[model samples]
Target: MDQEQIPGGPEGTGRRRFLALATGTATAAGLGSVAGCASGGDGTSGATLKGKGAGKGSTPEPGPGGFDVKAENARPGNADWRVTKAGPARAIEGFADRVSVLPGESFGLHVSTTAPRFTVSAYRMGWYGGARARLVWRSEALPGVRQPEPAVESGTRMVRTRWPRTATVDTKGWPEGCYLLRLDAQGGEGQRFVPVTVRSAAAAGRTVMVNAVATWQAYNRWGGYGSYDGPSGGYASRSLSVTFDRPYDYDDGAGLFLVYEAPLIALAERLGIPLAYATTTDVARERRLLEGAAAVLSPGHDEYWSPEQRAHVTAARDAGSNIAILGANCCFRRIRLEPSELGPDRTVVCYKSSYEQDPGFKRGHPATVDFRSAPGADPESSLLGVIYDGYPVDAPYVVTNPGHWLFEGTGVKAGDGFAHLVGVEYDKVSTGFPTPRPIEILAHSPVVCEGRPSHQDTAYYTVPSGAGVFATGTMRWVEALDATGDGRSGANHGLDARAGALTTRVTENLLRAFAAGPAGKTHPAQDNVNAVYGGS
Candidate 1:
């Protein structure tokens, strides 16, 4: 392979024709038109967005070995608001004091609502005896509690919601896995959820999967303010900081966990893979949690990262723990964790608009902005093998390097496009940033982003410490795990049956390999960057 001979290169007629045909067919089927190319662009072809397949509404039957395809129970209302309406309604919604806990530890709940009474139920998520989850415990109807109204700080535009503790749950015998606490108001006001992870004290020799709770809280807009939304409900009124004390306002408070994190957990448990669970805050507070783990799996839309969290995970990789980043736009935003009025590590501070607003901006620290931005200047590509490029795209995920081990048993070939698997946000390798050398470019799909033509890449790279890093370079990777195509709005990205099958196969391959000690020790990635791009 040579630079000009690459799949989407100018000299590759087959790929060009394939893309053209795929775009035309997609457009004819009522999907959106392909994005236009800018002049002097990289050698990649543009693709039209495709509609969700007609099989979107069909339920997937169990696969071989009795593997269940349904894991929607992890989310509140089982991914259907109608089901939530049919059940007991509740006005109160709350979240746990801590995003995660260990066995033998007690965690508190912070509730908010006008109802006078409510109850909590704990459901441990897994592939339990053909059912996706099992109810472990239920509380007697408890008095409903409300927190003080959120007050805006005068100077920073931060909303501090100092909620009083309502109830406490003891995890004396809770199993080590993902658990969702369902809050129901006896007054029929509706339902909501608080996600909790029971950390395994015995995480040695297991693969540790991290749930991106920090990112979820960062985007949470419960108190009329989020890191993305300002006081006036506009982007310009965005808050510089967000607190975790507030309940998520979307999807009955399940937030992004169900679509992005639960599918991977369900799939891992179904395969009976030895697994441990933790949150970004947990890793930041205690680095020892990652010790002796075979790998750390970061799944789905993990955009926000703290300095300590990055350092801990980087140290783990250097000590020979494999790293698998299963989504794009990962480690893109650099943020700092601070103790809120409630407790430690409860506030996420990121001044995305102006670095001057950051307390450490003038101290020569990594600015509270996108990692690749100035003053910080630490491109995530060095760690992720690819950097965030652009957004608002929905194109096919074309396989460029089918010979890689990650594609084993997928039956994909060069130029083969998995319908609607790449979308909304994607990443790519560029010489403009500090990328690891000798990296392999796997999926190089051309798509338009904000009117500029570019390419998205799935990359794999290995380090001398016998640690391997893999990135999917697309936000839709984990959402596609729901072969049934039932996902939260704005998260599913129109994935269908074919996309689900392809993503599941590749994910299984990645998990199995990473679970077995250091992946680079036995299956080192063969770098083809020079051969493909003619770079040094």
Candidate 2:
């Protein structure tokens, strides 16, 4: 939720009155004037942040207990240490960014404050059964010693500590959902909530499952900021891999990791729809996981794919199935994963070398086929009318596929706008990707050089097999909904209500289509979509 900025009043009377009122209220409530223990942590409540035994006028002695926004200059009475603005608070955001763990993976949460900083702890919240709530992940702050000063990076001051910010948390048994990680500091005015989602399960149902053949699970490794943010590491390069010690953790690499298909899940739960988690690998095994599923949900950032996964899904749809591709740069590369034990137990290494380096690892193998036109290429591009385009650009999206049933209740128009929906701009069905022209151009956003390059966002052709696929090449779709209450309003952020609803409907449509099939008929598209399309 966006915070409304309150206008500041006169310097003297206004400020004095506000402080006086706050002090009176605090006193009445038995709250301390000095920075004190925050509520709901293992530490004592109401303890000031002031250091214990130090000469007056000298630096205050370090306070006992944990502080979320630790800083050397921070003091019990300091007001500047607080974050009163919207968005991430500069002091503690570094520790609140993305945290990615594989299925059944365990990891730690680290928190360090600036010099003169206090203490902090973390918690988790999300949708359960249907309501929003949270649970404390830590009973108390992990132990650590404070240093007076630490090395500076990017010309900014930071405190150094060896606290056990690390822990062994696993993702193996949790159902896929949006999780909010709240970090709070002693003496700090408020808490910071970081949004993270457990990657969707690669299993379809009781039996069918998608495999995680070659999965690259690192964020900020290719470091590119949002389309509007400054250019950073590896933005211009196609791909590269960095080797780090097993269970490697970072505080600076927060920008790259974000929520996928965030809004769709919320909608599914709200509308009483069940979602199945699976990867391309599961699809290849002819697993019955998806057999009885009402809908298949692929959240944002589903870029890597395998040929068999593509073919089976298309075949299932031909028999009758529904699919929703919630984000962009999806189904672009056919990748191969060679398992290794050098990393954390569940961590797999997915190095991006040229597809030609090893013919066996090429895109045509069962693991890496491009399903574009059948026997070989991934059918995703042809099915969705898009291919993963290169990235680092954001542009407004225009609706062109207006006639499709997906827009049935949306009341959207031809020129209606969806902003920054396409990132890296690669898929344009009208131009190529073997997409049929008869496919409706429900939405189209024009692009031009802003010194850099751009691409168009388009939704094209349905499967000859009777399935419907929806793809948006934008990174912000799920995130946008959180910024705006309604997708079409464009108020809180740039999210569009119609866009949000359409995506959800499309996902439901696909799953329902797939479920309308025989118990073992994996590619039941024609039966699912209620239509028929046969190559012969």
Candidate 3:
């Protein structure tokens, strides 16, 4: 079920978003429950599941035997689940009133369609033995009507919808995982996707999956406006703020998920390790998030991050929770999460180069700028162990340290290169910023960005808290995981099966080790800064 798209043009590839607002205020708003959203008791006692960490979810089931993620994914999958017919942009489409929800909670569905009837199929994304997703819940055919067109706020240029709530989904017996609620019109007229995360409240000893919700909305151009360009396609007319209140455009209305996230989710779930889920928004507003988690997985293209989330994730890292950044330019943009018409933290505000006009900045709040920029001066390298460098590149990913534990199963010698594994955007270990010490360089790929020669570096470092952090330095890492064929937008950059095998093996290695607890205690990073940089 998909609708209006940001028409393909000179800047339609979505890569332009990476370069857009490369330089970038919003204020933190109080958290509140969406009007129609309410939790379904803990699923154990039906005791109202009240008090504390509302909507974050209850404690995750004990162990592999408890929730049985392996068994849950073993259920028969729907092969005809993809949104194959995106007939017209306005044929059928909708958005969830909430980004995520705890099991048993009910959330409103706001839909707009030219078709008279449409059905909602909730598909939890996982391996499903390569079926990729399992149909969890399906709704009876619901009546539809065209919602009012969204309007951009005069001052902020934010586009928001006032669509009426069409249906209320009750997640009583649903399993927690990343979900794509497919809206399908009757008679196969059209189809579009609306993503939602059934988040884990407590991730004490499981690998926590984090969906980059804010980044998804930041790049969403549903109403002909985004962080990159507005209706006129001028950078100056771009929205300073984007809201989750509206549905996304591009890739059948799935935003960046299928491209930068779904493949990785499939691989992770394929490993069948104990898993929990949360979005970046949950990390920012939830209490004690990731404190006792085994590991945290940040997906490809996770760029916009709120300061509150940075503090929370950094605290988790310092408390012995391993962190894996599988994307370039993660936590690079400082943002403010504010309340929307439906609920709290649904609006992401990033003033970009026009931060001076952001009221939050004037009030001494965190400016919505680059994490490494002024008024903050906190380089992402301080946490990511790599600084974001150049972009728009396609080069071979050269193995610099094939002996590293993360690459243990991937048989490759030093200098063995995987063509096109480093591209679009990249990061590098640089001493010029606030970087951690004892960081090891694993892959060093030479690339030409905008006709400038530079290099991409994959790195790892360990903090004294016994937590180990590894960064992939390239956004293509996730895309390559599914390189044998399926690319959501055909954005796999020609990476072949070899590259796919290489990424999968290393990812498996990383997840298995990190899930056991603090990885620094078992496999500490070997420093090679001098060897890689030649003493600078």
Candidate 4:
């Protein structure tokens, strides 16, 4: 894709004129300072920031029960200590039995190491009185053993580590929230992490936040085989099926959680929104988890999904549970789950190839390929109001419908562009797909993708069931929350202070409104796609 065609690109004079109009309108409106911007050193306005400890210039203080802040220097982008770096390179590394579990349930850990022993610590992530995470528990140095990577099987290309359990942490008293289990080998060689969420089954009247674990496992290359084969080989070597029996090879075992999911989780907690947590697998196996929820949140980069999981979420929305997709490229791949040698429903199978290559394809099942492709033909746009477009381009997020409630504050106006917010991958409401009628395309930023001129869209749509659906239409939505570009989010994506503030305000508005209940019941989306673009 040519960079010159993107919004705010060097060759786009129209965008410059629109920017002038937007800036002028905002200045004339006399929008005051967004609340809470200065108070919380974290850069988010209206929310009290916590967890700024010693590493970031704040005083080192013990958390509840005198638990030491072991990861004092742990911040974004520091690869070594950041909760997201992948590991086991001359260091002890591990992963959890499950991405999430209910309180009072037992959670297991699988550790791999070159050292004889290692210590484990649990930090509950939240806005805890200026500390981002509070030390909850720690384990003594325990015996460890390194395990060999599992060999790839024939047709499926599935890899299973079959590593034995290293530790089991009882979750009897742990609060329902995001937690990072940190592992450090003896001799201080290095450290890594495994992210878990202690979920709540009783989600009545609360928003349900789902961590995209399936996508993480799909991309995990712990056994040298992810969905996408690395430089070592091509599609022939890629794993058609991946098991959760091994540690993640990226983001310190957190996979894509830090980049795509963590920021949104932190922000939701900071706002004290009534919330519960779960994994994509959890929802797939148990539909009842979202039965009475007020809303469901799908994080950034939720690409792979099973039919059962899709049905559950769609049914929940039909029952009036609002859904907010905070990123693009969501539900793009159709996968099927099967019981692993370790446990049930631990294997995700997606053969991104020809129908003949997929065993299930011949059975008249949804082809294990892109959701919008082939026999299934179930376009995500029908559910998300936008479909996955092209990739590898970065463009400004230009607001076209700033008057919508989602952009209530922060002084945004028509044609206001948040630089570099549209990136990596994006979505659009296209007539070629099954788009929901009466959808509102909020941001219409033009960019060139695969040498073709196209526009990315952030959209909102309402259904008769009183469910409100929203899509950010960009993969960088969550990363923009790191207003300071501190690398906590891994890559900065060129986001600046203005972009952060604008995104934060817009996110706050979305969450607050959705938390009230089904937003369609109160503020139904008015179809503006035709009005804005002059066509259906």
Best by TM-score: 3
Ranking by TM-score: 3, 4, 1, 2
Q: Residues 136-242, candidate 2, lDDT per residue (tens digit)? A: 22223322222122221131111122223222222333224334444444445334444344434333321121222223232322122111111332322312222
lDDT of each: 0.70, 0.37, 0.79, 0.70
**CA lDDT for candidate 4:** 0.70
When summed lDDT is taken over every stretch of 10 residues in candidate 1, the lowest stretch is 1-10
lDDT string for model 3 (1-536, tens) is: 12111111012343354433221011112221112222122211111111122122222344652355776666656666798899876888888888989976867777788987777777778887789977766654666677788888999999988776766666665678888989999887899999988887788888898999999888888888888788777778888888998888877878788888998888888888888899999999985978789999999989999999999899999999999999898998899998988889999999977899999889888889888889867999999999999767778899999899888878889999987788778999999898898899999889888888888999999999999999999988898888875332334677778889899899999989988889999999889999988984
- As for TM-score, the candidate ahead, 1 or 2, is 1
All models, RMSD in angstroms: 17.0, 15.7, 8.4, 15.0
Off by over 4 Å in 1: 1-83, 86-90, 360-365, 485-491, 534-536
- Over 4 Å off in model 2, which ranges? 1-133, 136-219, 222-239, 242-259, 278-292, 306-319, 340-380, 389-395, 419-426, 430-432, 436-439, 449-457, 460-465, 473-476, 483-536
Candidate 1 C-alpha lDDT tens digits along 199-218: 76645677888989888877
lDDT of 4 by residue, 1-536 (tens): 00011011011121121111111001111111111211112211111111111222222233331212222223221122344333347367777766677765666677778877666666666555335565555554566677555677878777776665655555544456677878877776668878888776756678888988888887787767777763365655677788887777766666787777777877876776677778888899897878878889998779889988999999998999899999888998889887876567788888766556776667776778778877767888888989988766678889998788888888888898877888878898887788877788889999898688989999999998898999999888887886666333334766787778877888999988888888998888888887767787
- Candidates 3 and 4: which is better by TM-score? 3
Name the lDDT of candidate 3: 0.79
After aligning candidate 3 to the native by TM-score, how far in Å is the CA of 391 from where it should be?
1.1
